[model samples]
Target chain A: MSFIEKLKNAWVSNNSLLCIGLDPDTEKFPDLFKTMAKPEAVFAFNKAIIDATHDLVCAYKPQIAYFSAEAAETSLEQTIAYIKTQYPHIPVILDAKRGDIGSTAQKYAAEAFERYQADAVTVNPYLGLDSITPFTAYRERGTILLCRTSNSGAADLQDLSVDGIPLYQKVAITARDHWNSHNNCLLVVGATWPEQMAAIRQLVGDMPFLVPGVGAQGGDVNAMVKAGKTADGNGLIISSSRAVLYASNGDDFAQAARAVALSLRQQINVARA
Target chain B: MSFIEKLKNAWVSNNSLLCIGLDPDTEKFPDLFKTMAKPEAVFAFNKAIIDATHDLVCAYKPQIAYFSAEAAETSLEQTIAYIKTQYPHIPVILDAKRGDIGSTAQKYAAEAFERYQADAVTVNPYLGLDSITPFTAYRERGTILLCRTSNSGAADLQDLSVDGIPLYQKVAITARDHWNSHNNCLLVVGATWPEQMAAIRQLVGDMPFLVPGVGAQGGDVNAMVKAGKTADGNGLIISSSRAVLYASNGDDFAQAARAVALSLRQQINVARA
Candidate 1:
């Protein structure tokens, strides 16, 4: 199925647009798992989180760095396997933000799609068409290009005006005009900037946005949904990382996460309506 | 030793400012190695090339995409190991251009520095200060920020203006003022645009530059040195990939690569003088 259709199906079936970000900061993980002496503890913790919130979210974004940083390749492979087998329907967006020259990008595309088997992946578009083409080449997967980010320093370069348009606007247009020819492109607009989100929504039309910065980052979900949602009310995938994943660092962590995910989903639905 | 001091020593010791780019295109490998297997062949070729050119250039820049695209983690690891072990004095710049959030970036920093053991790595500063801080946090390694790239589409954003300052100039100044507080930052200016290089040089003062766009990309090295070199003539690490590594596709490929590296180094020395 196409990425959009799959996303819509997942959203409707799960009755949620919230994407649980599995950043898995080792320092933030429960002490029990930290002292487990093996990487399996990390995967076991992730499994519990997925089990608790799988029904409450449309997608799961596993930030690749967390896994790769631990030098836990096996854990990464197993976690991906579990997500694909156990969740089945929930799309996985590997938050890799990878970009390189054409030939190199092909390898990354293969790694994310073929090896990890993610439904979508985040990409950096600074290298231009060649860097983005390899990811978009995979017709079945979604490619989320970084546009206006939520970080305090985003204005350092993204706010500059190219020709007559801000750099982010130009990125949106290029993503819309050139890269999305395959209809698999998405824009990553931080929920922190609703005005930019609204403007980019106008430039990008009906394309889906993987919007981060909603919860712990203090982005207003209602404002973001108002600015980011498609006319059909299916364009936004609002993600919350620490606020949802670590709602409680104690034993009720999984339940706390589920509550957070459920509340965000309901909030998104209300805002969409 | 500080990254800048190491670079200075390499420059004087090698008597060459040229940085040999290790962008090993699988298709461009000599026919002899093609039959050896996928990544093994790639590594074998890289080892041979590095062995031949180690003394000819001051630094070796491995464009991460080429090795990464092949799903060849072993080869990538081996290639980096080979460079670090064989040429301890020469710096290795992993051209990954990675940038992300704070937590994620910490992992990337570990991957590039702790795992690959590169002397420096290229970064995309689109996400702002938090994205770049993790890399610069490692005070011992150099973090080269993408100021102006060598691609045709660079103008899509890099040339944009903000508050009367060109985007690239703003990025250069930002890197100099904000990110350089650790004193471990560098800028990436494409050798393709000499005028921009000159303008950025004036903006950034004396920080070292990892220039790529010589050779196959058609960047003018002489013009680039004229515009990009520091007043003391110690701030450029001009890189040529396709023109050097793929100089010939025969058994003597390594020798051909060494010859090109020598010539480029000679050219850079003469231009600076």
Candidate 2:
């Protein structure tokens, strides 16, 4: 099935918009991981989290740098495989924000889709269309572009007026019109900027958004749901990482994570109603 | 030594500004590599290219996508180690245009600097200051930001008017003024756009540029040298990948790669003169 179909299926079947970001830091691992190898610990933690919260989320996102930093690419592979094998319905978005020229972009596409078997990958728009064409070429995969990021410094360049439109809005409009021929394109509109997200939703229509910066980043969940959700309340893939993943540094971390995921999902639904 | 110091040392010692990009594609690998495993083939190819042309270049850029796509991170690690150990003065630029939120950016920084030990890494400037602070925090490393890319689609957003100045120029100005507190920032001004390169040179004032698109991509060597070179004629790292690495698919591959590297280096020097 195509990425969009799978995403819609996940949203309906799970009845949730929450996406759990599996950004593991070995330094924060529980005592269970201290005795095990780095890769083993990461996979174990991810497996436990997935087991605990698989029914609560619409998707799973694994930030690539966390795995690559620890030289735990194998663990990342295991984590994705475990998710695919076990859940089968929850799409995986590899949050890689990769961008380069065409030839190099092809290799990155291969890395995300072929090497890791992710259903979607986030890409940077700074290099423009050709850098993105390679990822969007995978008609079955989703290409998520960074629009307005959650960081405070996101305003530095994203807010620069481009012929009166903010650069991020231009990015949203460009991706929606010119870059979405395959209908596999999406924008990453930060939940931290609710007004911008609302404006982008109006500009991009029903194109789904992978919304980050809600839970641990202190973004207002109510504002994000009101601003970012589609008419059917299905467009936002609200992501929360550190808050959900490291809720507790104990053996009951997975249960704690589940509690956090359930609460966030309920919060999003409340705002939706 | 700092990345800039090492880069300058290499330019003086080798009398070349050329940076050979190690972007291996298995389908294009020579017959000898067909017998070896993918990682082994990649590392062997890189080692041969580095051995054959190390004296003729200022830096070795291993595009991370090539390695990650093939699950050959080990090969990339080996290649960088080989250069750092044998050709200590020659910097290695990992052409990974990575950008993310501050927390995730810290992990990406570790992946590039600690895991791979690259002297520098390419980054996308779209995320603004906080996304870049983690990278620039490493005072000795070079953080090369994309300005005007070599691809045709580069003009998609880069040429947009931002307060009357083009967006790429704003990026150049911002990097020069705000992001270079450590003096470790550089711009990637493509050789395909020489006039823009010259304009950025005027804006950024002697800050180095990692120039791609010269050989196979049809960028003008002479135009780039005249446009991008610093006051000391030492600012550009002219990188050519396919034209050098895939010069032959036969037994004399390394020698052919060296010949291409030598010719490109000479071409750059002639332009400098």
Candidate 3:
């Protein structure tokens, strides 16, 4: 199935817009799991989290650097495969902001899809079209472009005016008119900057956004929904990484994580209501 | 023992400014090497290139994508170790344009320095200070920041105006005034835009620039030397990847690569004269 179809399926069937970011730090892993092998521990923690809240989330977003940093690559692969087996319909977005020239980009696309089996991947727009075309060519896979990110420095270049328009607006327009021919394109607008997210949504027109920066980042879910939602009120994948994943560092971390996920999802629904 | 000191030592000792980019594509490898095992083949290919051109070059830049694309991860580690042991003084700038939030950036820094043992690693400054501070904290390692890239679509964002200044110019200024506190930071100024390269050189004074886009990208090498050089005429690492590495697809590809690197070096020196 196409990534968009799977995403929509997860959204409607699960009745959710929350994407749990699995950004693991070994330093923060619970004592019981930390005693296992590095890869084993990561997979265990991820499996426990997936088991608890797979039903409540539209998707799971894992940041690849966490695995690469720890050399838990095999565990990341296992984590993705486990999710596919346990919850077959829920998509996984690899939050790897990869950007390179054409050939190298092809390699990274392969790494994200073939090695880790991520349904969607995030890419940086720094190098422009040629850097992105390889990933966008994967008709079945989703290409989520980083537009206005959650961080303050996102304004460093992303908000700079290009011919009287900010660079992110141009990116949204480009994705809408040029790159979305396969309809495999999406945008990542930070929940921290809901106004920019709303403006970008207007420009891109109903293209699904994978919004990060809420909860731990102090972004209000209410503002995000009011500003970023399409007319249907369900066009955003609101992501909360640390607040959900590390809700409690004890043995009941999985249960605590589920509690956080459920609350965030409920909060998003409340805002929609 | 700092990146600049080692880079300067290589520059003077080698009497060359060329940094050969080791971006080996397996499909493009010679039939002879193709018969070897994947990891063995990659290591052999890299060793051959390094051995042949070590004397003619200032540094070796290995783009991590090539190894990751082929799953030749072990070979990449071995390749870096081999360079450090065989050519002890030449720096290896691992061209991984990594960017993420702070804690994640620390992991990437670990991946580049502790895992691979690269003398320097290229980082994308999109996420700003928090993403970069961990990298800059490694005072002995070179933190090469992407300023004005060589690709045509670089104008998409890097060329956009922030107030009255272009974003890239602002980046150059940021690197100059704020980020280079450790005196280990460098900027990536492409040979494709010698005019912008020149303007950046004036802004940055004598800070070393790790330049690409010299050969396969149709960038003028002579113009780059004339425009990008500091007053000392030794403040650049002009890199050429495919043009040198894949000069011949036959069995003599290694020798052919050496010939190209030598000619490129001589041409750069002539321009310097």
**Among all candidates shown, the one with the greatest TM-score:** 2
Q: What lDDT score is found at residue B142 in candidate 2? A: 93
In terms of docking quality, how is candidate 1 classified?
medium
| Residue-wise C-alpha lDDT for candidate 1, range A1-273, written one tens digit per residue | 867788999989988889988877767877668777456777887888999998888888888877766666567678878988987888889898887656567877877888778889999988788778888888999999999988887876788777778889989998888878899999899999899999999998898999988899999989889999888888888889999878888888899988988899999999999
Tens-digit lDDT track of model 2 for A1-273 = 998999999999999999999999889887888999889999999999999999999999999999999999999999999999999999999999999888889999999999999999999988889889999999999999999999988998999998789999999989988888899999998988889999999998999999999788999999889999999988999999999999999988999999999999999999998
Q: Model 1, residue B233: displacement in angstroms?
A: 2.9
In model 3, the fraction of reference contacts reproduced equals: 0.51
**What would the C-alpha RMSD of candidate 1 be, to one decimal place?**
2.4
Each prediction's fraction of true contacts recovered: 0.50, 0.86, 0.51
Model 3's DockQ?
0.61
In model 3, the clashing pairs are: none
Point out the higher-scoring one by DockQ: 2 or 3.
2
Query: Lowest-scoring 10 consecutive residues by lDDT in candidate 1 chain A?
Result: A68-77
Candidate 1, residue B144: Cα displacement in angstroms equals 0.3
lDDT of model 2 at position B71 = 98
> How well is each residue in B145-258 modelled by candidate 1, as lDDT tens digits?
998888776765677667787778888888888888889999999998899999999988889898988998888878999999898887999998889889899888889988
lDDT of 3 by residue, B9-87 (tens): 9999999999999987888888989779987998999999999999999999999888876777788899999999999
Runs in model 3 with CA error above 4 Å?
A: none
Cα-based lDDT for every prediction: 0.85, 0.93, 0.88
